[model samples]
Target: MSGVLVIAEHRQGELREATLEALGAALELAPQTGRQVVTAVLADDPQALAGPLMGRTHGLRLMAHPDLTAFNPEMYLPVLEDAIAAAEPGLILMPHSSQGMDLAPALAGRLGLPLVTDCIGLTYQDGALTAQRQVYGGKVSETLVLKPASMYVCTLQGGAFEAPETSAVDTAGEEITLTELSPAHARRFVEYVAGALEDVDIAAADILVSVGRGIGGPENVPLAEELADALGATVSCSRPVADVGWLPKSRQVGTSGKTVRPKVYLALGISGAFQHQAGMKNSGTIIAVNKDPRAPIFAVAHYGLVADLFEVLPKLKDKLAG
Candidate 1:
């Protein structure tokens, strides 16, 4: 009857946002399942990576080994399997990123455990864990539950959960190091390639003014830019904008694009599709402007304005300028 185990992911000597978000998901599930939250990080410097997550978990397991510095499924599988064996967690959580996508399935297969991938929602009910997954590119939702298994593995969708705030806790994390793991020579460490060419990371932006197909055409993209300028924010868009050559692929925000956690997200003309929401749902404030009153974006949006972007943008720009 122990707690959940979150497999933390790090890159370039820093913990990724998905790691904290997975912790957030674990924190939410803990109350329902009545289990403590334990996080496991496999890295060269586990102590440095585990610093920020100190009070956040009931225990922090650092599987530090030189071979784990880089992300390779060949090296990660055995190390993670060892960590899971020691933890014996009821549930294991991994981020649904490139690393998790490669690692989770193989790890689950190796351990003969049931795994649910790209889960948007997770809850404990009837003494079983239920996960919600979006099918058909966020059009349909299916709930999955595993039975007769002592342990379960789940991959949390990016930006699906909020990052937990730092709180001072009296409890200190218990760190354990595993020395038995050795590098799997099947794959060798290679150089890391940058995903975006731009220096500005949309994922790191605090305020983002995003547009979708509702902006009518590519010409209206400048209006979103103007609004972003006035608000001292960055301009981002949905996949359609980038698809039509209106914006660069780097500015696209969705399941296939960069996941952002901006402080204020102004989504204009976006239909609030699940794919788009998957990237920005964790924003501190989501102000959605769409003519359709029934748009799904409003469900997660903190503020909603039912109106045309043509009229709303000018007024917003004028007000902000004044």
Candidate 2:
């Protein structure tokens, strides 16, 4: 294996945090699997996006073209194929985001390499890579092993890896730019259709009181609201709460919804499924209140109270109010 190649992702000219997180994963694996880390930044002008990543990788390949303003399959596909052929990296890591979802599978299929998506854990042992991902509503975990080949491609789950800390100190890393842009394409880029603005932006909330199926009924949701009001926190929910129409989809948190990193996340009557945990697991302090002590939410919580939330809510709310 030559090295690890990280395909960086960006949006609207700004580098996405997922890029740094992918780099972090690549950096960790480089020692175990590769001798170097090469990050390929595909953009119109990679200068701005490549700045923070200067000392972060063994090499930065700035793949540039005018049509690269927005993500286009036709524009990105050929260039990435060429880069892979040139780099011959043992491992290829990218974000499991919208762009990555589109790119990774197609990249692997075209090149006949092993591929995995939305991986939460990755390990290299005995010259093979093992990927861990969620299954069956996050209740079951699936471990997939990829046998060694020329290389392997993987898309990482959001919030799974911490973004790497960066500095301006010089390293032995090299910077290289490529201008071999795909000239002709049948499809052209179009304007983005944005979703309607939500009344509340839960992603920006520092404190979130999130509910789930265990909340029982929609009528009982006010208990959570009251607690949120008393604590000056925002109300969020797991997927079931939103699916049952108890809350708007905007307030939902999980893989199929939004990812949040609040200062405090209070899970009330929530089971703490893997999908739900993936969204808010990185909160500063996690406190779970559930009747079932074995609820999966407790596994990631910093503080837990195994009791009925119906009994806990009013008391906790009043205590905060007092």
Off by over 4 Å in 1: 27-35, 125-127, 133-142, 158-189, 195-209, 213-235, 254-266, 273-275, 278-294, 302-322
Judge candidate 1 at residue 307 and give its lDDT: 95
Candidate 1 lDDT by residue in tens digits, 192-271? 86666864678888899999988888887888888888888999989888789788889999887888999999999888
lDDT of 2 by residue, 1-322 (tens): 6678998888888998888888888887877874788888888887778877877777888877777878887788888888888888988999998889988998888788899999988888767889999776555789998877768999998778877768522434444465566634667778987655687999999999999898999999998998898889999999999999999988999876888999999999899887788788889999999898778888889999999999999899778868
TM-score of each: 0.73, 0.83
Output the number of the lDDT-best candidate: 2
TM-score for candidate 2 = 0.83
Clashing pairs in 1: none
Q: Can you tell me which runs of candidate 2 are displaced by over 4 Å?
A: 167-188, 193-195, 201-207, 229-233, 254-264, 273-275, 282-284, 291-294, 307-322
Q: Which clashing pairs does model 2 show?
A: none
Q: What is the model-wide C-alpha lDDT for candidate 1? A: 0.83
